[model samples]
Target chain A: MTTMKDIAKVLGLNESTVSRALNNHPYVRPETREKVMEAARRMNYRPNTLARSLATSRSYVVGLVISNIANLFFAEVTKGIEEVADAHGYSVILCDTGRNPAKELKYLDLLARRQVDGIIFMSGRLPAHVVAAIKQQSCPVVTISRDGTRHGIPTVRINNRAEAAKATRYLINLGHRRIGFISGQLDDAESGLPRLEGYRAALEESGIEFDPAIVQEGDFRMESGMRACARIMQAAPRPTAIFAANDEMAIGAMKTLSQLGFKVPADVAVIGFDDTAFATVVTPPLTTIAQPLRMLGTSAMEMLLKLMAGQRLAEIETVLECQLVVRASCGGTGL
Target chain B: MTTMKDIAKVLGLNESTVSRALNNHPYVRPETREKVMEAARRMNYRPNTLARSLATSRSYVVGLVISNIANLFFAEVTKGIEEVADAHGYSVILCDTGRNPAKELKYLDLLARRQVDGIIFMSGRLPAHVVAAIKQQSCPVVTISRDGTRHGIPTVRINNRAEAAKATRYLINLGHRRIGFISGQLDDAESGLPRLEGYRAALEESGIEFDPAIVQEGDFRMESGMRACARIMQAAPRPTAIFAANDEMAIGAMKTLSQLGFKVPADVAVIGFDDTAFATVVTPPLTTIAQPLRMLGTSAMEMLLKLMAGQRLAEIETVLECQLVVRASCGGTGL
Candidate 1:
């Protein structure tokens, strides 16, 4: 139970002086600070961070609301956030909501009640209630993957519509006329709906008719993708290529295609978004839309830090670019 | 801004009575508690959890020390930990060390100083300094994937050695000689070294001579596995089969095989440890030893909870089982 008082007594210094020295206050002499630190270490003094935080209103902790950590896309983003948080001497309280709005909101209120200095909202979609709560809370918030620009909240996200269109155009360029699309929650305004629109736009530009029967809904899960494949396989004039909203579904579609006696790129082709770790591991190294996830996480965290420091954001919606990674899955040469 | 006192004054009751009702104390009538909750919600009262925690010397927070969250195995384990912690109304402070010893130790010290109710050590290996720190800290520590039996620490882990031997024997039973083994750090007593021993044991039991040249090191990463695959290919006698320590490495090796113009199962049959998500995504889906990662995480958290509740562990080491998932990579029917 050694305390600042004990260090002060050991060094024959005033209690206030010891506290100032330990806190690295400018008023304390450097020599006095070193002496106090040495004494504190020798005594094995553990500071009461709770009390210190109460006094300074700085907990050195932040909240990170992530959609799903099991997904490699979010997992890599979390890694990036952690790297930055750790470097800044801050700990993160990760709340994985599994895409449940209720769970996400519950965590939001809980984090605010726990007095986190700031929060990083890393969910894919921004619901109205959550935006309202964020606006009401005194703490700063930075959104990742969703545009929170209209609400005056800073956001870091990639151009989903543009990237999705690029992916579709790439498939069209590869001589894919009858292409099927596996979408993730077509109702999702931020990502799914936009991606579907991109596919339709590409088809329109290529003078190819968009067939609703060939498009299936997948929840961005492998099983859903497999199920979607079944639907697409039964459609008239079966598609020669399939584009999934994400890599998991694409991999799942590949698995189903193989099970149904179809060889990838030989009989059919496939493409995926979010070039996650699974992209490279899959048989043909999937062609995908690569978003700089680590950068996304890093930038979001940095934005929150700046906001927490009482600085106004310079950018409202920080949009990052996505790259089209050509791989064997899309009949691209390994070379 | 609404306090219990305000509710008490408005209801013509004592503040203590209102507080007891809101807390759902046993002495408070159910009707009164319900009324108080309604009033609190109507008034939008937010509880000051910080003050209550300070008074009770409890933060309702636990520390989860994980090696790497980007690894799907760890991510699933984290999901399990979060599920259990949330059920108990506790938040997890995730400290992903990325297998860095210094970072791990720093987080350990930080968690201790932050006064986390308990800690779950989820690293592949527990260093001596960490063990020493765990012993010295007041907070209870539960370890996952390591044998903490000797140090009086409760542990939840699968039988790595037995599982490894089983996988090796399965390969041997398939009439494979000149088998290659890709391992994590051989010096890692917790997982790598034991798995290596298991491989040797299986080889000796099968009357197959153990050759050092066939074994290579992989740091549980895809790139490391790829590099090891290259080295194994250059061995005096190339291996007919390979067993990578984990699925990421196995997938990497598979990619290397394909790039080198070798087909899996046809040229070199392969198996992997930890049937991660990548196992099923890969072409010729990998056959692997599936560790109950979520159960391991759940059990570890439960063990720490018991220890925190002043209960002594009846068993120090809680060993879980591993299952053999046969897939296309090992030339096994999808059955």
Candidate 2:
């Protein structure tokens, strides 16, 4: 391993000069810095990251806590985060809790132990006590797609209630009065409650009577969505339109509808949220609310970076707007 | 901050006993350990990870080097890795290179400096010199979905050649004599060569003459697949079937085929590799070779753990089999 001393000796400069140049300290002369860099590159001198981290208390690494990576929506968000993290010379350590609170706690402990510079919590809702513990540890945390204001933590999220309402209102405008909703698991702490509220709010505004019988819960899985759609199909005066909380469920509902000889946007119109990659690939395409997944990810990372730098954020809750993409499923021209 | 001495004094036990109890060391008496744990819990004694790591020279964290997390196939593999790592009380530090070799090298250095117990390289075709450098660092490394034979490193992957050949043979059995191939980026060090070889081998065995004009290159992306399909369609006497290296490309090809008024299976049979989540959701569903994604992830982590333990593994390469999942696109029952 080549050290700073070796580079200094090779460049006929003091070790401190070489160190300053490597750190890009402004005091180092440009010409001398170039010579030092050339010598360091030639020697393949790699800095001692551990020693530097101990001295500076910055790991140049961020921790990302996610519920599951298999979900396309989260996957897209992760990509966005990765792009920004890389641009800032920060590596991301991902912890997937499988939506288990206990597992989430375990990962929190692990990240704390590693002394990561900052953390971005996505999808899974952390327990209040755990959040308190994280704050006590003095770790910078930015939550995404989950409310963090009560905990005094910064957050990035899409307006789930408004997006859901927009999708519902779109269906209502399409001359469909009897609309049904397929929700993610009601137990889901972050998304379930707000999305269902949005659906109800839209119905109330449209002067349409809300029917509890028309609502079904899914586990935010395609198979669960399929089963949930089956339950909705069995209800009397079946809805002429259905809105799924996310695209996966919407695709599943479409499959069930197609099997039952229902033509999308002809016999029924369907709308989904999150507009995952499959939303455009599915038959008849899908009219869905786009969540700006990549932007959500990148913004969360940037916010966490700011928090780590001891900077006051402009907003505690950064609410990104959602766009409704109309496609054939909602009786719109194909993209 | 409650130290071992404080806990020991409170529990009327030696500091070593308290440490052993907290670490769940087998030598501690069961009843005494239980008492110590109860006291420690009451005291809110959180173990100092940095101190523990310095004492043990092991942090219980593994490094995961992946080319990209946005790809569904890699995401599934990551989920599998996470399951095993979490179960074993290990956390994964993810390093995504986005297929950039320079970024991969930077991550390897960072992980080494962080003193990760081991590393799992997934889909990152690291250069020989870089792999050699990692080996010299004496950290255990296990490669997934790529061969690490040159560097004498442990690897876990599916038999790509055989799987591709099987997919092509299936198409031939479906009475498609003129088959087209959509190869993933030829520049990729992994998958490209083996898959192309498999395609050629299948054609030779079926006594069908291979046509260079029928093969198109894709970047394993949906848009790339669509473009490649369009080029293949423009070829004289278009192929009756197309085999894509992965599901995303296959779906893209299907989209283009549908737009051209070609009915899947009846007009052009399509097969894809890697049965991702969206494989079944697409309109003609995809027939794909299913890699044991979860198993691959789990095995890589296990191998890395063993390596970290200084165990000598005789077989460096672990090859898992791939299954052909027939779906509507290939004239089979939909999944």
* Candidate maximizing TM-score: 1
Error of 1 at B286 (Å): 1.5
| lDDT of each residue in B1-335, candidate 1, tens digit only | 56778888877788889879977789988887888888888878777666667678898899999988887888989988888888898889989998888888888899988878999988756667878988887889988877677787788888788999999998998889789999988888888888888888999998999988889998888999999998898887789999998888888899899889998999999999998788888888899999887788788889888988899888887899999999989896432
Report lDDT (Cα) of residue A13, candidate 2: 84
Task: Please give, for residues B143-215, the per-residue lDDT of candidate 2 as tens digits.
Answer: 8977686677789888788889999998888788999999998876579878988999999998999998889
TM-score of every candidate relative to the true structure: 0.91, 0.87
Model 1 has a clash total of 0
DockQ values of all predictions: 0.61, 0.50
lDDT digits (tens) for residues A63-130 of candidate 2: 88898897777888999998888788787788887788876777777777667888888746667776
lDDT of each: 0.87, 0.84
Model 1 steric clash pairs: none
lDDT for each residue of candidate 1 in A1-335, tens digit (9 for 90 to 100): 67778888889999899998887899988898999999998999988777677667788889989888877888899988988988898899989898889888999899887878999987757777889988877789988877588777888988888888889889888888999999999888778888998888889988999998989999999999999998998998999999999999999999899899998988889999998888988887889999898899888888888888898887777898998999888896432
**Clashing residue pairs, candidate 2?**
none
State candidate 2's DockQ.
0.50
